[model samples]
Target chain A: MKYTVIVKPKKAILDPQGKAIKKVAENYFGKDIGDIRVGKYFEIESSEPKETIEELANKILSNDVTEDYEVIES
Target chain B: MKVAIIRFLGTNCDYDCKYACDVLGIKSEFVWHEETSLKGFDCVILPGGFSYGDYLRSGVLAKFSPIMNAVREFANKGGYVMGICNGFQILTESRLLPGVLLKNNNLRFIHKDVYLKTEGSRCYFLKDSNKNLLKMPIAHGEGNYFCTKEQLEYLKDNDMIVLRYASEDGSVDEDANPNGSVFNIAGICNEKGNVFGLMPHPERAVGHLGIDGEEIWKSLLE
Candidate 1:
């Protein structure tokens, strides 16, 4: 099975990369830039079942401490 | 105090940590990743680097190393353990410290000197001194700390909040929070007060090399 792991920083945390991009945008396009946030996406193939993959996502794939992850079957 | 600095495959700060400890007059040893013992050191340090290539997650893969079992045992026996940068991630992954470190809120690697406010006088690693703040350098892409609301409340209630990011002017109020950490936390101690994980590189600050590094080392040694 193929799994797509979408990992994102929990809300209330700053996204420094996103901010840097925003700064770059402002530098090029001039101020008036708006909000920005960033996240990561990963694709993996596993022989494990969906339930097992979900558990893996929680236990090791994604950090529940500061990130929330969702799994989509491909 | 005798110190053991764990050396995982990709750890780059073991030597630096050892040098800092050596400067402080502490005997230091490097324990390999597969080692199952801490070798009688009173303190163990997990230094920073791209451990396990930061592959599965920063420090997540390293958490399962054989040496970590020994680390867990050491912490259980009231030994002092510290994690810096990648080390901090390892501690969180091992469940030795509360909260997990996520990618920097801005999503880029940050390397700079920042002010840190000491939360209280209870952490063994920080000594029981009543100092109010510390200035140190932090370099990492994944240093944003996260925990449950109840965990935050518990840390506050027990004074486990060790260090907080401060403004450039060294004021530690809401506006001074740099990484948007919950309660502006920069570091924290375990309930036993023995395990400490901080995002900043105190080793980098422990000399004339940068801001009051020598004093920070002296304070830790005290």
Candidate 2:
């Protein structure tokens, strides 16, 4: 099975890398930039069931304190 | 108080912590991570460094060292314990503290002096401290602290919230939070208030090394 995990920081928490990138984009492309949020994307190949993979995502791959993750079939 | 600094295979700050204790007129010893005895020490410190090359996770591997068994026992007996930077990661991995430190939000190693606000008035380490704002140096790639909202409330209710980051002008500002730590928390004390773990390096702050590191050490002794 092929799966993709998208991990993103929770809204209440600040994203420094996202902020820095936004600053660069605004400076170079003029101030009409749309929303841009930085996150981690992981693509994995595994024989485990989808449920097991989701558990792994919650347990280790994503920090539940300040991050949320969504799994998609690749 | 006699202090013991744990030296794991890759610890680089054991000597620095020893020197800081020496300046405080406290006898400090370096305890090998494999040692099982923590006798004759009132406090034990897990100094900063890339323990186990930060392999699986910062401090994850070091938590299994034999010394940590003794350290945990000592802490359970009401002895003082402190962990800095990588040490903080070890504490969390061992479940001594509440949360884990993820990579910096910026995805880059940050090294700078940041201001921290004292969270309470009774912590033994920060007692009788005049300045509410502390300027300390922080150098790390995995220092973003995270915790559940329930845990955060519990810490606040129990007065475990120790030091929080502040702006250059000593004001609490969300934008000034360096590593995206929730609640702007830079450091936290265990529920007993004896164990403390922080990302900032007070050892690096001592002397005229540019910031008031000596005074901070003195406060702990006081």
Candidate 3:
């Protein structure tokens, strides 16, 4: 099965890269943008069992301290 | 006492660490990451560099290397293990130390001399009294340390926090924080004080900078 994983910086943590992009975008978009948060998207193809894939997502693909991840479209 | 400097695939500071060891009169050598045994070694150092190209996250992939299992066992058995810069990130990611190092708040890769103050820390690496404020060089992009509130409290109660960015007056204040680390923390030792990780490279600062970083090296031979 294939899985799409979305990893994002935690809400409490600062995302300076995203903020920099948001600033550049606001110069053109003129205050219409709500928020621009940055994150990582991973498309993984694995034949492992679902539990194992879940473990991979939690253990290897995501960091609990500064990030959150979601497995989508498996 | 002999020291083992574990060299990961992308490590570039192993030689500097080895040099520091030599200048400190301690025998040391490069130990490949694949080696499974840390037997007969009194100290192990995971030196700094862009290990695994800092992929996924700094020190994330390097934490899973074959030798880390042995490193973990060694640390658990009250052995001295230390990580510097990129190695520090690896120690946190590997859960040998608490918290995580995230991108700097200003999103800049800072490389310059910074002041660090140590206070009553029981880490084996620090030999001087708590009053010394050392000027050391730090080079990294992702070094902002964060943790849960309870974890922060636990760290405080146990005196796990060993180093903090300081002002010229030796105060740890918001303006002194270069990387937005919580409480301005630059280094931390494990609960047992055996495993240590820090954003600054003490090995690189030895003998060339303000206060010789040899105070840290002196602990290795003790």
**Recovered fraction of real interface contacts per model:** 0.77, 0.38, 0.85
Using Cα atoms, each model's DockQ against the true complex is 0.48, 0.26, 0.86
> Residue-wise lDDT of candidate 3 within B1-222, one digit each (tens)?
888999998999999899888877899978999999999998899999999999989999998899999999999999999999998999999999999998999999999888888866778788543446877889999999988889999899998988999998888899999998999999999878889899988887776543447767877765
Q: What is the C-alpha local distance difference test score of candidate 2?
A: 0.82
Q: TM-scores of the models, in the given order?
A: 0.82, 0.77, 0.96
> What TM-score results for chain B when candidate 3 is compared with the true chain B?
0.96
Could you give the DockQ of candidate 3?
A: 0.86
Docking class of 3: high
Q: After superposition, how far is residue B117 of candidate 3 from its true place, in Å?
A: 1.0
Please provide, for model 2 over B87-146, each residue's C-alpha lDDT reduced to its tens digit, 9 standing for 90 to 100. Answer: 998888777888878778778899999988887734556765677778889999999888
**DockQ of candidate 2 relative to the true structure:** 0.26
lDDT at position B147, candidate 3: 88
* Sort order, TM-score high to low: 3, 1, 2
Q: What lDDT score is found at residue B10 in candidate 2?
A: 93
TM-score of 3: 0.96
Residue-wise C-alpha lDDT for candidate 2, range A1-74, written one tens digit per residue:
99998888888767677778888899999895876777878898999888988987776566565688998877
Worst 10 residues of 1 chain B by lDDT: B211-220
